[model samples]
Target: MNPTEWRTYLVTQESRSAGRETAAVVEAALSGGVDAVQLREKGRPARERYELGRRLRDLTADAGVPLIVNDRIDLAAAVDADGVHLGQSDLPAEIARGRLGDEAIVGVSASTVPEARAAAEAGADYLGVGAVYRTGTKDVPDETNGVGPERVAAIADAVDLPVVGIGGIDAGNAGAVTAAGAAGVAVVSAVTAAADPRAAAAELREVVGDGR
Candidate 1:
């Protein structure tokens, strides 16, 4: 993937069955037009996470979409994932760069103007911004966080890197998300929790225009 695709879909596993359901949901998302998939399963046992990473990497590879592991450089390397996506609380972009090298794609989450600029300067390939609408994740959320499209636009305007919008985005309101300047939208529960994962992914693709 070029990493500049207009609609990047992220799949983060949040519950007990996340590991088991991740592959199928990710495959459906790819079939529906997701450019990149990030395997973000936090707080799980290391052994479980490693196996999950392997499954995601294989599925993404077969689908021809890049798979990035969230917050774990070691697991990324272990599973031969395409890259790593890091949050502000995770490893620094420059250090991640050093660890992963220039060939891999590295993304950093940024909420404020300075943070976005710093991540760019530090060599991040892209930026993931939000909690745009209050997410089920993030305990002590970013201060500037909110799902307002305007706020997401503000962050996008502040940096040159490709931007991905996260936090509560879905079919009912994804239009405002893209209109706000997001290159893509990352979701967890929307597709995974749906009765039909493929249908959910297809609907989201319609909302975001299949990454254009």
Candidate 2:
């Protein structure tokens, strides 16, 4: 499915999974209704991440969900993942699309209108825009987190590509992001750390659906 049609996107982080493996959490999330999945095991050895990506690639394939490798085009190709998500610090989107080929989905992370427009012009298939609320998913600085729905609104208006609001989003607040015009919302702890990842994803799915 095109990410433009997704209502919920899941970014994996095993460290916050409360002991479950990343693939396990992702499987549960898929059962619950995630439209897309991203393998984002930062700091792990390349071999380890490749192994995990292989697992995720299989799971997402069987579920007919797109699997995106975070910040690693080579790994995405290695795992035969559906796509790659690039941070501003990562390779340029044109380079990603060029290397991954025309059929590959290329996404870029953006926090502002200028960044969003740049990404769209750079050949991004979609944009992951935020740290929408204060988050602990990573060491996000105070200024980036809590940028709010207004940021979503601004970026959404500035770009034509689908926008997925990320960071600190959960069922309770995901609606705000979508309401502000995001095509979807991406979450880490909201599902990965939940006691029941499937139910968390299901609830979030419902919220995002309602949000639209």
Q: Which candidate is the best by TM-score?
A: 2
| lDDT of candidate 1 over 82-179, digit per residue (tens) | 88998888989888789888888999987777888999999998888777787765553656457477877888898888888888778877778888
Q: After superposition, how far is residue 156 of candidate 2 from its true place, in Å?
A: 0.5
The residue pairs in collision within model 1 are 7-211, 132-146, 132-147, 133-147
Best by lDDT: 2
Model 2: per-residue Cα lDDT over 1-212, one tens digit each: 79889999999999999999998999999999999999999999999999999999999999999999999999999999999999989999999999999999999999888889999999999999889998888877687788899999999988889999998899999999999999999999999999999999999999999988
Q: Roughly what TM-score does model 2 have, to 2 decimal places?
A: 0.98
Off by over 4 Å in 2: none
Q: What is the lDDT of residue 169 in candidate 1?
A: 79
Lowest lDDT 10-residue stretch of candidate 2 = 137-146
Q: What is the alpha-carbon lDDT of model 1 when measured against the actual structure? A: 0.78
